[model samples]
Target: MSPRNPMNARKQRIDDLAASSVVVDDAGTVDEAPGVSLIASAWRRLRRDPVFLLGAAITGLFILVAIIAPWIAPHDPDARLLIDQVSRQSNPIPGPQAGFPLGGDDRGRDLLSRLIVGSRQTLLVGVAATLLGLLGGLILGILAGAFGGAVDSFVMRAVDVMLSIPSLLLAVSIAALARQPSQWTVIIAIAVVQIPIFARLLRGSMLAQRSSDHVLAARALGVKRSAIIFRHMVPNSLGPVIVQSTLVLATSIIDAAALSFLGLGNPDDAKPEWGQMLGQAQQYIQDYPHLAIYPALCIVFVALGFTLMGESLREALDPKSRR
Candidate 1:
C-alpha cells in the first residue's frame, strides 16, 4: 500500500522480529544473589557519613593491628633487658636504650611491643564478653517479648534487679569473689554485667516488633509461634540489637581494662595486655612517660574505633535514616 510508508514498513519489521523472539522465564529472584553489591552499597553509605567513615577506618586499622601484631611488633613483648639497669633513673639525655621510639617501661620491657600484644587480649575479652552477653540476652529477650505474660514479667523483674545494681560494682564484686580473675573470669564478669542491659534492650525492641503489621499478618497466616518469633520477629529486631552490641563491645573493652588496672584481671606476669601494661606503667608515669602514654593511647584508639563503628551501625540501621 504505497510501499507501506517507509516508517510504517520499519515498524512492521520490528514487530515481526519481536513476535519471533524467544521468551525466557526468569525463575531467579532478587534474594538469590545477595553479594558484594550489598557491601559496596553499605560502604558507599558509610562514605557519605564522615564520622562513620573515620570510625570504620580506625576500627579496621585496629583489627588489622590485632591480627598482625606478632609480625609487626619490633621486640619481644616480654623481653627484659638489664643492659641499662643503672639508667633506670629518668635521664634527660634520651639514650637509645632509655628513650625507645615509644620508650621502655621501668622493667625495661618494650612499651610498643607490649602495646601491640596487649591489643589481642583486650579485643578477645571485649568480643567474648559481648558474645556471651548477646547469647544470654537474646534468649531471655525473645522469650519475654514473644510470650508476653508470666515469662515477660519474670524476665523484666530479673532485669530490674540487675539494673538496680551498678554495673561496675557488680563486675568488681564478681571479680573479687572469683579469688583469681583469669581471662575467662574477666570475660564472665563482663558478660554477667552486660546481660541485664542486653536483655532489656532486646525485650523492648522485640515487644515493639511483635505488634507490627508483618507480625500480625504472620500470626493471621497461622504460622507457628516459634517460627513467628525466630524467623519473622528476631530478624526484624536485629537492627537495634546490632547497634547496641557494638556499643556493648566498647564498654566491655573498657571494663576489661578497668579490671586489669585494679588487679582483678590478668596475672602479674601475663604477656602484654593493655590493662596490665597500664597497671605497670602507672608506677613509672613520671620517670618514663612513654610507658603510660603508649598504652593509654592504645586504649583510647581502640575505644574510639568501637564507638565510631557503633554510631555508623546505629545510623545505618535506623529506619528514618534509610528514608
Candidate 2:
C-alpha cells in the first residue's frame, strides 16, 4: 500500500479515538468526556442493593405525601362536622356515616385529615431542628477539630456535659421554662438537644479529614485558615455529617412528638399533630381504636422511612460501612 499522508493518518487516529470516547450532550453543549453518567451509574449501583432501593422508595413516598397533603386529604383538616361530634360522643361503630374513614377525635376532627396535617408538622419540626443543629455543630465542631488545643478541650468538654444530660429531660426543662411552647420553641428545644450529637459526629469527621493529604496540601499552600476549615475541611467531612443529620431528623421528630404528647408543645387547640393526636386519642382508645391506630401508624411509618433512609445513606457514604 502507498504511504498515507501525515495529516490523513492523524485524522484517522482522531476519528478512532472519538469513536471510543464517551459523548455527553447536555442541552446544546456537547461534552466528549470519559466519565460515568451520574444517573445511570447511581441507578446501577442502587439496583444492586435492594435495601437501599426500598429505603429510597419509602423516603420518597413520605416526602411526596407530605408535599401533597392538602390536596390529597379527603376532608378539610380544620372542618368540623355534626356527625363527627356525635360519633365521638356515642362510641359509634366505624363506618362512612361517622364522617371519618378512620374515626373522629374527641373534638370531632377527622383523624385522617389530622394525620395528613400532622405529617407536615412533624417533617417541618424535624427538618428545621436538624438544619439548625447541623449548622451550629459543623461550625463549632470544625473549629474545635481543625484547631486542637484549649479550644478543642473546652468545646468537647462542653459537648460531654450536654451529652451527659438526658436529651428528653433537657427538652422538657426548656419547654417548661418557656411560658408558651410554640412551634419555634419546640424546634429550638429539639435543636439544642441535638447539638451535642452533631457536634461530636462532625468533630470526629473533621479530625479524620484534617490529616488527609489534600487538607495538608491546602495548608501548605498558605490558604487562609478560615477558608481551609470552612470551604475545604467542612465540605470534605460532610459525608458522615449528612448521614448523621438524617438520623437526627428521625430522632428529633420523635422527640418533638413526645414533647407534644406530654403537653409541652404547640397549644392543645392546635389543628393536628401526631403526638397531640396520639395524646388526645388516649381518652377515646376503647371507643375508637382507629383514631389512635392511624396516627401511631403514621408515626411508625414516617420514623421508619427516615431510619431506613439514614441507614442506606450511612452505608453508601461511609467507607467502613461499605466494606
Candidate 3:
C-alpha cells in the first residue's frame, strides 16, 4: 500500500472528529420538556394572579346562581306577598321578613327571590347580546382585513359612522323602532351599539397581523390567501379580541340593565329580570332603599367581576409582560 494522500488523511481525520462529537441520547423520546404555548403561559399567569382569582370566583358564583336560581330561590319570583296580612302592618311597603330576607318591592314581590331568578335573565341578555355583537364584528373585521381596498374602506367607514352615534342613544332608537319592547329587543339594541366597538378592535388587530412576519412568510410560501387569512392571521390576532370580549360582557350587562330600567326590556312584570326589578323599585326607592340597593349591588358586583377578569387577562396576555 502506497503512503496515504495528505488530503485524504486530513479528510479522514475530520470525519473521525465529527463522528466522535456526536452524542445521541439513549432514550427513544425527546428528554427536554415541551415548550409551553402562549395560552398556557397566560393561563398560568392568570392562576397565580390574586385579582384574577377573585374575579373568577365572583363570576363563577354569579353564574352558579344564575344556573340554579329556580332550585335555590326560596319563593317563586312572581309570587306576591301581603305583609299587611302577615305582619298586620298599616304601611304598604314591606320590609324584610321571615320568608323574604332581602325585602319586598312595591308590588309585594319577594326581592330576594326575584333577584335570584333575575340573575338568569340578566346573564342571558348579557351573554346573548355579547355573542351577537362578537359574531357581527368578527364578520366585518374579517371582510375588511382579508379584502383590502374598497371593502376595507367601506366596512371601516360604516364602523366609524356607527361609532359617531352615541351608543345608548342608538340602542334606545333601535329599541323604539321594534314592534314590541322585549328582552330580545333590548339585546338587539345593545348588540347593535356594540358592533362598531368590536369591529374596530378586530379590524385593527387583523390589519396588524396582515403585516406580521409569519403572515408574510406564509404568503411567500404560496399558501392560499384564505388559509393565510383565516388560519394564520385570524387565529394569532384573536388574543386581543378574546380579552375584549370579557370586557364587552361587562358593558353588555350594564346596557341590558339600562334598557330594562327605561321600560324597554321585557314588559312582562312577572318575568324576574334585574333591570325590570330595578325599574319597579324606583317608586319605592325612598321608602324602601333595600329594593334598589340589592339589585344595584348585584349589577355592580357582577360587572366588577367581568372587569377584573378582563383586565387581568389583558395584562397577562400582553407581549410586554413576558420576561
Clashing pairs in 3: none
TM-score: the better of candidates 2 and 3 = 3
TM-score of 3: 0.86
Evaluated at residue 119, the lDDT of candidate 1 is 85
Report the Cα RMSD per candidate. Answer: 8.4, 9.7, 6.1
Kindly list the per-residue Cα lDDT of model 1 for residues 1-323, writing each as its tens digit: 45558889899989998989666667555556655654466667777888787878888888888889899988887876533542644542232454357655666666677788788888888999999999998988888888999999999999999889999889988888887768888899999999988888888889899889999998999999999988988887776887898889988998888888888887854477888777766776776676667777888888888898888877765647652
lDDT tens digits by residue: candidate 2, 1-323: 98889999999999998889666665386669777753455455656777776767877887788889889887887766534345534545344454466755555557677788778887888899899988889877986888999999999999999889999999888788888877778889988988888888888988888889988998899999889888888887787888888788888888888888888888844567788777776776885677778777877777787787778767765546663
By TM-score, the better pick of 1 and 3 is: 3
Compose the digit string of candidate 3's lDDT tens values, residues 34-66: 899988989999898999999999999999999
Best by lDDT: 3
Show where candidate 1 strays beyond 4 Å: 1-44, 82-99, 321-323
Order the candidates by lDDT, highest first: 3, 1, 2
- The regions of model 3 sitting more than 4 angstroms off are 1-34, 83-90, 321-323
Ranking by TM-score: 3, 2, 1
lDDT of each: 0.80, 0.78, 0.88
